[model samples]
Target: MTITCQEILKTHEHLWQEATVHPFLDGCKQGTITPEQFNTWLVQDYQFVVEFTRMLARILSVAPRHHFDVLLGGLTALKDELNWFQVKAAERNLSLDVSKQRTCEEYSQFLESFARTPYAVQATGLWAVELAYNQGWQLPGHIPEPYTEFADRWGNLGFTDYVKLLEQQADEMLGNASPDIQKEAEETVITVAQFEKAFWQMAFNAT
Candidate 1:
């Protein structure tokens, strides 16, 4: 049985909704989130990105030749993301070094486990992860001032287009994968969605 990324998303659409729609994002949209809340989440996300960058590198090492350009470009963006975080942190008087919260550590471990998975599995999983952020921030429509940058960075036209490319890549990879690989990829999306949801709650609770 062949599975496309769309089918995987459709099958777990409820879980996807759970991960993407949350009070945290709602707060962001409403402009009710305090600087402390936002900053805490930003710091945690920076740490998450650090691990995410590592995962991207490991997955790229084993990625198919055709995937080289997209995956490599993703790494470059991630590098810029880290520097962006530092610049933002300095503006807020926030420190980049801090303890990883329970959810962040668990999420990191979850991402790490995918390192040895098949390329199809990793690519599909990566798509699910990015799509959550893309939709999560975009779904809210109008974001007020101050917080617009956060949503715009991930939800803007450029990022949305890039995510579509990722979707196409994952779908192409899964189309040629074994049934077992497809099955694992579906499961990987579910697991990643769970972490995404938890990470949002963790950030919200910090407020």
Candidate 2:
């Protein structure tokens, strides 16, 4: 079987399951996540988003000409995403100034290290991070009231399509990559998946 980028990612399905079905997400889906827990996640995630945007900018700087528009679209989306975080924080009386948790710090470092790497590896990392959230929240069943907004932000069709586009882009990049680049890209995916689990664990711990 010819292994594709998504197939390489799926090889770590166990880790993805641990990440997507985490207790934190379960709490969100049930509308039972405490304010403190939600705030912790929101604030830590805001920190991640800041780094994520930086990573996206770095990727944009190095992405191939063919991939420019799609990457730019993602960069544009991050601006609104940051605004949404701020708005939601204010509505919940939550301060976005909360310190970054250990997981967030580690994940930020991981993403930052890819700043000048091959675009294929960067795209793989991006796909892994976004897919983790999308798959986690887009699970079957209604998301309860308080968390519906959060779910929709990540799980909505627009975001779903965006992730799919990223996936396709990553696969295209990987298809022409050298063997070493392909190996590195798969490693990046697994590492990001592990980070996804740690991120969820950090949120659950705050509860």
Candidate 3:
């Protein structure tokens, strides 16, 4: 009985697609997003990464021993990623200390709640969240300037490869879990998709 993330993704097919290709990404591709709007994502997402990195560290601590190497790589990349976000924000004169918008705050709180879930749930949710960004930025059509570099940051081959690695690890975790844990993990993926969609929408709609 090998359960898979693909099964969960297919279970919520419409939501999976919507979460990854929402209007915000469409705006990004068309270069319709203003600098202020971009700042909303930059500031909020940097904050989200901080919490997400913490969650990855927690997930690493409890994940199966064989999964450590990949989780460690994720943690390391996040350290560099935090720095990358800082540099990008500074270059654009965006402040990173602003208050988290409602969606961002709720998402951060949600990530923290993973402390109570099984490793399967944590790992699967993490994979789903990353997949959304990878898909969103990798969308067809030219991404205008500044946004092009950001797109490359997440949508590039390297990042896509990394996300694939994560998907494999998460699926492996889910496959070996108990029936209850597997079901919880699948539900967690759906929750992550909902949050991903909201996070993107938050950026585009923020005043």
Task: Give the winner by TM-score.
Answer: 1
Runs with alpha carbons beyond 4 Å of true place in candidate 3: none
- What lDDT does candidate 2 reach at residue 117? 73
lDDT of 3 by residue, 114-177 (tens): 9899887888888888888888889755688868988877788888888888889888878789
Q: Each candidate's lDDT (Cα)?
A: 0.90, 0.86, 0.85
- Top model by lDDT, which number? 1
Q: Model 2, 28-126: lDDT tens per residue?
A: 877777878888888899999999999999888888898888889998999999999999999989888877888899999999899767988898889
Q: How does candidate 2 fare on TM-score?
A: 0.95
Candidate 2: minimum summed lDDT over ten consecutive residues — where?
Answer: 1-10
Candidate 3 has which clashing residue pairs, if any?
Answer: none
Per-candidate TM vs. native? 0.96, 0.95, 0.95
Candidate 1's error at 110, in angstroms?
A: 1.1
RMSD of each: 1.2, 1.5, 1.3
lDDT over C-alpha atoms for residue 32 of model 3? 83
Pairing residues by index, what is the TM-score of model 1?
A: 0.96
Whole-model lDDT, model 1:
0.90
